[model samples]
Target: MFVLLITALIKYANVPDDIPARLAAARLPELVPPSSLLYLRVFMLAINLWAIVLKLQMIEDKVIFHSPESQLPRRVEIRLSGFMWCSFFTFQAWALQTFYLAGALASSMSAVYGTPDLGARLPVALWFAFEVSFAVAVLTSFIVKYVLIPRKVQNGASVAGFFGLPDLLMHNCNTLFMALELLFADLPVLLSHFPLAALWGLFYVVFSWGWLARHGVCWYEFLDPSLPKAIVMHSVVLGVLGVFFAIGAALAAGAATISSPYVRIALVLVGVASVARTGLITGIPEPPVGAKKE
Candidate 1:
């Protein structure tokens, strides 16, 4: 199911030759550096593949080495674990980000090289999908690690459920590595780039609205802009989420320099404030009429 969904999304986002030709004809400068995109694509793919291989090895060790007498049961356990892990929101976000980077790299290369018939470029949907996924990956990792885990611990939930070496390596470590890679690979972590994250969210919101305009199908209940209140709420929530993720990504990249206790305290305060602000605003209104089921 994971494979099928990813394959379908890739096919949907695959850029046709006409797109590059159109861009060339328009004579617009390629905004993205092709080399950077290439490096990012390689890095993301290598890390994800390595993580998968590691997980498979761990599964093999568990099933073959430790549980040899229970071979069939171990196999079932491994398969079930694999399925559950793949179905995780974090894993899906990681997969989407990986595929999106691949598409973006291909598209950027096509634009840079004047490849009118390049078959690997990404469409806007795929591009937006990747950007959103990147944000989701960062935010999800941050919340799970810093917020959710602590809350779970305070509530007497088993810490064993929250911390596993395999899960940390696959989800948190990979995300941090990717963030660091982006920082070093000519994509400087900047306060200015943060707005681009919010802009990406707004773009997705508008894109969904455009879909509804043409097809009469609202892609998401919160995105039906026909309701003025829904528009305000969705815009604010997405915009805030985008900015929060952007901040998290930047901090992850700059983790080496964040040695001061004061800075850490400030970051925690800011994060808490942002979450409080979002919750307060979101709770003020009921679901918009457009969001209600018929």
Candidate 2:
């Protein structure tokens, strides 16, 4: 019966000759060869590393901003000092992908046709990186393209000069890399594992608060304690990330038995969902009433 077959595939079989696995899913080996998956991991890792290098170069060079649409005579530079480099949420999400991909790449090199013996972190980290990177990529691009750039233009300034191919690699291309890995590998995500990313967001919230206490400057307007609605902003961002994780988990779970092309089409919908969450089509996100823009 279909029920019996499903149970048989997911059930543990720790026979003397069999490999051990903590995960229950028994994926078909014919779906993808290990070598091909390994190569994809390599590509993802390399792109993240390159993006990190470019981000660091931009920071070190104190990249200045300008655009043909700008009316300002003076150039505005992206100014971050000391530990401020890690304060950006986009940077943290991008770096986390690099970290996860490097580890995933090493493990995938020897992927074989047997129950995979994986560490505690890889599965959860994969889900966390996948969800966060997708959400950040969606939100950052929209904020930059619609909100930040146009606001700067209205102010007789522009920030587009600072965005480059490196920007493309870091903020926009994350979902592509993640989707490729998802196609070739099993992205295990359970409902319980959703907290890991919320915890990650919490960790950054505390770290950013510490930076504000020590440096007396908050780079992000939403998280500034001087603002009355800062806590509300923090809660909203964390809530959005949780929504992303839940959606990603559902998509991954649904894709477990589907063909690769179907999975690809379904994954594309996640980005579209994120765009809808941003409310870009309806209106530009404005500050809550009476909260002066920092």
Candidate 3:
């Protein structure tokens, strides 16, 4: 995460001043009007920020409850939990991506639509960074909620107790909202771009391996590449999961065309059944060590 932030900062700092003018001159269709895009970015940013705040509050509450005087029988600590970490990373990615997108759109509006702005414009590279990051964020959020969380539940893990309603809405429900937005809200997401999600996952895997090499510790147990077959098996499983998620998103988008209520219901049922079948074959993951039971 720090690496991503520093890279974004360096990229933003090096942006050429006239890049927006050049982009404007390229005659890019205002497929989405600048003002509308700005509004959407702002909305996404706000929601993601709220999610972050809620997450912090959850952490704080847990800490308070586990204080020495609380006399709690066994406090469930989630600070290092995979679900918590995944949520944190997803929120950060979404927030930063939204911020960068908002800035880029604002700059574009100023250059192309003669809208007033506070300062300089962002370069195309920064825009690309933000867009790709946003795509990665959406994919990560979907995989964590659908693949990781459900697997944990099925394996008798007390994953749900670590999160409250707000967290659930932010981490789980927001993925669905993002998918719907991509399908119905005319966002920039496309089927061809789905591979980028897998690329992001590959990058993360490499990054995690590097971190383990340096720190002699693994952030996620499943990602401990040190074991003889761990890296190979983990990489294969993640690749397959990424492809499955991408296909699911594409199918959901395609399903938007079926206007009939009964057909939609049938499609949804089929989708659920397919997910169940996959889960049964793969088996849900057990709670990580240190996960407290209810």
Candidate 4:
């Protein structure tokens, strides 16, 4: 069943190509080659979404809501939950990653095979925006389930706080915005889609804000909060990375494209290191409070 769904979902879809890349070329083409690598890029996106949905379903049934916990079954469930949470984090990280990937792939293809048509590019562009928004929605959902939900559990806050009314409304608004953007993409002017995309982004920001408030975080705690330190810690770490990337860019100058390979390699290494670190931390044992020494 999973294989069937994946194959069905990932089948290559028709794409338009007359993007910015073609405008820079000496001559513009009316249509792009269907076999062109750019046209097939959406298949890769479909595969990613299919995989995530499958893994999420599997994790929920096999680990998160397991009926029993004891002996090997208990140990396996614990390990699987940890693994599922890691998957959640990766899904979250893919937000910016997918945006860049999709943009770069499409632009690069446009450079190679020429642009398809204004009509074609509009649908694809709107699709790209919709994909990014979906990525945000999935990431936010994962963060809520694993981080915010767990923190609320630990902090004795009302479960209702975790699913506040405001966040729900913003979440629904973002969803509707994405739906409208895609609905009108090919049928209307390309520029018309931008408003919906912008609205989605705005609602997303508001949703994140409401998330923080619902979590009981104060503005002062933005830097370093004792409660749910992961939020602050991840922010600081990403900030440091942004700084490092900026410095690298400055040092590389115009010819810094030569260093692109090394940067890509370094990113892979960091991802591996993070996965290992998560595994190690999850493996640690937690002692019960007020338990007498054995």
Which lDDT values do the candidates have, in the order given?
0.47, 0.54, 0.47, 0.35
Which ranking of candidates, highest TM-score first? 2, 3, 1, 4
lDDT of 2 by residue, 1-294 (tens): 212322243334222222212122223346556666666677778878877776666544343333323332224445664445556766777777676677566556435443344554344434445555554555555555555555654544434443566665655566556555545556554556455566667777787778656655454555555566667878887777667667666666766556675556666656554433222354434444554332
Better of 1 and 4 by TM-score: 1
lDDT of 3 by residue, 1-294 (tens): 533543455444544465444333321123444455545545765666676566555543232112222223223433433234443445545555545545555655675568875343334444334435534544555556566566556544555442555455444434443433333233232344444445556666777667445434343445555455676767765666456546545544554566564564455445434322222355534566665543
Error of 4 at 189 (Å): 31
Clashes of 3: 0
Q: Which pairs of residues have clashing backbones in candidate 4?
A: 17-116, 18-116, 18-117
TM-scores for every predicted model: 0.43, 0.66, 0.52, 0.33
By TM-score, the best candidate is 2
Model 3 scores worst on lDDT over the 10 consecutive residues at 61-70
> What would you estimate as the lDDT of candidate 2?
0.54
Preferred candidate (lDDT higher): 1 or 2:
2
Off by over 4 Å in 4: 1-47, 55-93, 117-206, 212-238, 247-294
Identify the candidate with maximal lDDT: 2
Candidates 2 and 4 compared: the better one by TM-score is 2
**lDDT tens readout by residue for model 4, 153-203:** 453433442233333322232223222222212211232233333343344
- Tell me how far the alpha carbon of residue 265 in candidate 4 is from the true structure, in angstroms, after superposition: 5.0
The root-mean-square deviation over C-alpha atoms between each candidate and the true structure, in angstroms, is 15.5, 10.3, 9.7, 14.9
